[model samples]
Target chain A: EAGVTQSPTHLIKTRGQQATLRCSPISGHTSVYWYQQALGLGLQFLLWYDEGEERNRGNFPPRFSGRQFPNYSSELNVNALELEDSALYLCASSSRLGYEQFFGPGTRLTVL
Target chain B: QQQVKQSPQSLIVQKGGISIINCAYENTAFDYFPWYQQFPGKGPALLIAIRPDVSEKKEGRFTISFNKSAKQFSLHIMDSQPGDSATYFCAARWGGTSYGKLTFGQGTILTVHP
Candidate 1:
């Protein structure tokens, strides 16, 4: 089976601009998750979406937000992007709430 | 706040030797504890996982040893190979969280030399 897939493998944006990252979960998966991997830093949870509903979120700021579509795909939007926003944004999916999560290739976001 | 702490920011081991990485958690509920392997350019992939009830779980040459009392867990790579070099992360999640909404460690970069 195809694992999670993300779009715009690489994205470049400037300070104060906005960036949008997309993710398509694996087939038959209902829960989608977003995370930020900043260079040497480890992965930090960003948001969680399940069955078209916003389930939970992480410690990130309000400027960082996202939504899940009816088809279980997800989008992460970072507004007022700052240099600190530059990182590899990863997406993952699972069939249930507490199952194995499969991750995507990730999108490398560069904010200048 | 829940947290997963990983040790040895980096490690180097000769080929065919054993490589071990350690992690500790703050006891945030619990249903799953997982380890992920990632190369330089790719996202992490689940290497192996264990539930709290099990003291240890093994797959292939990889093994995870969990100590419930100490709230510590570790990953042991037996017969470590050069190809096994990569960044390995330990993560945990409680019952109220989603599958991927995990509390991850800082990650350990393992370098196995030939």
Candidate 2:
């Protein structure tokens, strides 16, 4: 089976601009998650989506938001991007009942 | 608050030697402990995992020793190699959370020399 896939392998945006990143989960997976790996911050959970609903989110600000489609694909949007927003944004997927999450090659976002 | 703490921000070992990375978590509610390996410019991949119920779990050349009573876990790489050079992360999650909502360590960069 194909693994989780993300589009726009890398992104560049200026300060105060908006950026959107996309992800496609594995064919049979129903749950999608977003994570941000900023410098020195390690991997921080951003959001979780299941059944087309926002299930949970991390400690990030409201400017960091995302949605999951019925097909289980997800999109992460960061508004009013700041230079601090530069980081590798990863997407992962798993079955609704599973604990194992398979991650995709992340989209590296660089905010200038 | 950082729920998970990892020791030795970086590690270096010779080929055929053992590489050890340790992590401790404060949350007892975290039942699933996993180790992830990440190559530069790539996403992290699951290397091995263990639950609180098991004291140890081993895969080819990779082993996870779990100390549930101490709330600590460590990853041991046997016969380390240059191919194993990368950043390793220790993560924890609560059960039944579907996506698992990982709490990750600061990451340990491992460099293996020939």
Candidate 3:
């Protein structure tokens, strides 16, 4: 089976612009997670979606939002992107009843 | 507390030696502890995972030693090889309303020399 997949391996944007990143979870997986790996910040959970509902979120700002589709794919949206937003955004997937998570290659977003 | 503190941000070990990385988490509610390995330009892959119920779990050359009361865990790679050079991360997650959310520690870069 294929692991989690992300699109637009690299994204570029300027300050005040918005950026959208996408992810597709493995088949039979119903839970998707988004994480931001910013420089020196480590990997921080951004959002968690299961069964098309936003389950939980991290301590990120309101600008960071995302949603999961019926197919379990997810999209992470960063509004009013700042230079600090330049980092690798990763998406992970797991069975709704599982604790093991599989991650995607991530989309490297560069904000100027 | 949802923080996982990892020690020795970087590690160097000789081939055929042992590489040890330690991590201490602050949250006692975290029942699942996992270690991840990541190569540059790639996403992290699950190396091993252990629940607090077990003190140790070993797979192949990797071993996870968990200390539930101490809220600490360590990863030991036996007979480490050059191919093991990569970044390693320790993560923790709780259940219930906080399920599906993982708090990862600052990664440790391991460099194995031949």
- The candidate scoring highest on TM-score is 3
Better of 1 and 2 by TM-score: 2
Model 2 C-alpha lDDT per residue in residues B1-114, reported as the tens digit of each score: 999999889999999999999999998778788899999988899999998999999999999999988899999999999999999999998655433688999999999999
lDDT of 3 at B15: 99
List, residue by residue over A1-112, the lDDT tens digit for candidate 2.
8999998999999999999999999999999999999998999999999889898899899999999987889999999999999999999998996788889999999999
lDDT of 1 by residue, A15-110 (tens): 999999999999999999999999766788899899998888988999999999989999999999999999999999988765688899999999
Candidates, ranked, TM-score: 3, 2, 1
Give the TM-scores of the predictions, in the order they appear: 0.96, 0.97, 0.98
Which has the better TM-score: candidate 1, or candidate 3?
Answer: 3
In model 1, the runs with Cα more than 4 Å from the true position are: B97-100
Could you arrange the candidates by DockQ from highest to lowest?
Answer: 3, 1, 2
DockQ-derived CAPRI band for the predicted complex in model 3: high
Q: Interface RMSD for candidate number 2? A: 1.8
Best by lDDT: 3
TM-score of 1: 0.96
Model 3 Cα lDDT, one tens digit per residue, B5-39: 99789999999999999999887778799999999
Better of 1 and 3 by DockQ: 3
Pitting candidate 2 against candidate 3, the one with the higher lDDT is 3
Q: Distance (Å) between predicted and true CA of A107, model 3?
A: 0.1
Clashes of 2: 0
